[model samples]
Target: MFDVLQVGQQHGTSTDRSRIGAEPVLLSLSPTIVGSRGGAMVTMRSGQAAQAALREEHWQEMERFGDFLTDEDLAALPQTIRDGLIGVRRPGGMRYPAFQIVNWGDGTKEVPPAWLQLVELLAPAGWNDEFLILWTSAPNAYLEGASPAQTIQSFPTEVTAELRYAAERAIPTRPGGPGSWQ
Candidate 1:
């Protein structure tokens, strides 16, 4: 588990009168964004700091008749959004990123806004969903060790900034010219 020292003031002032101080308060954070001020910290009970889990390249079936999503739901998305999905093939068959599908119950589903934006940004940069899935799920230093997916769901603004930073970092610089390759 990793400990992210969050200064409360860095986020924003809270109206709650019970808080310790008006200034920043150091918080122990976790893997997922907790409350607005505190986050769920990954446990480090083993004495050694826990690292973010490495993502494997394998894909899950987009049409899996499972609780996550179904074939009919995938068919219901707008064509443009549907086309934007990254497809991969393993020995089994074509599959999509499991993270892209959000189950809202009653068989309803939605793709996250942050996720869609990241896909749009990365597509022009020659980055694919395979890269996106891994990158977004992996722990990020900019997010204070939180994964992009986790940050996006709770702290929307922070995630957008992180995305912009990523785009800037991914832009290729020419040897002597100002223009980027893409």
Candidate 2:
């Protein structure tokens, strides 16, 4: 029951530019146990445990997959989507390691291998937390050639329209793709 949000101005003139606002991305995610490589546990203080469990289940599915997609599929993404996802990282402001997860679909075609693989790679295990949900929607800030813009380097700023726009744009929506999850 959480929505991701981001804050930062679009920098540069397109080519040699970048977004240098916050880091670590304070995820407004659902509460769940984060398993680390060493099996340490940390929980979110302001989120739902059940929802976090569900999200973990989704991520686990990705971990179970090995090369579920092909190079062709990754390359096929709209250039914007590809660029956006290819080099994404957690926002720097975060106190601990975290990622803004996205809800795409339950299939290979609908979800990319890199993204699928990333969810697993980034979500190694150890840290955990309770997530917070908002009544408003997120943004659509899809990257240049990566996965749809679902996750955002977020902070506690009271989810605003501007934040939603950034998220939506970050997430590259395929012309006739699935809508946002409640």
Model 1 segments more than 4 A misplaced: 1-84, 103-108, 155-159, 175-182
- For model 2, residues 12-87, the per-residue Cα lDDT tens digits are 3323235455343334333334444346555543344566657555434433553123335446555544433322
For model 1, what is the error of residue 35's alpha carbon versus the real structure, in angstroms, after optimal superposition? 50
Candidate 2 is scored at a TM of 0.21
Show where candidate 2 strays beyond 4 Å. Answer: 1-38, 43-48, 58-72, 84-182
lDDT of 2: 0.34
What are the Cα lDDT values of the candidates?
0.52, 0.34
Candidate closest to the true structure, highest TM-score: 1
- Model 1 residue 96 lDDT score: 58
Compared to the true structure, candidate 1 yields what TM-score? 0.45
Clashing residue pairs in candidate 1, if any? 1-50, 29-41, 30-40, 30-41, 30-42, 34-39
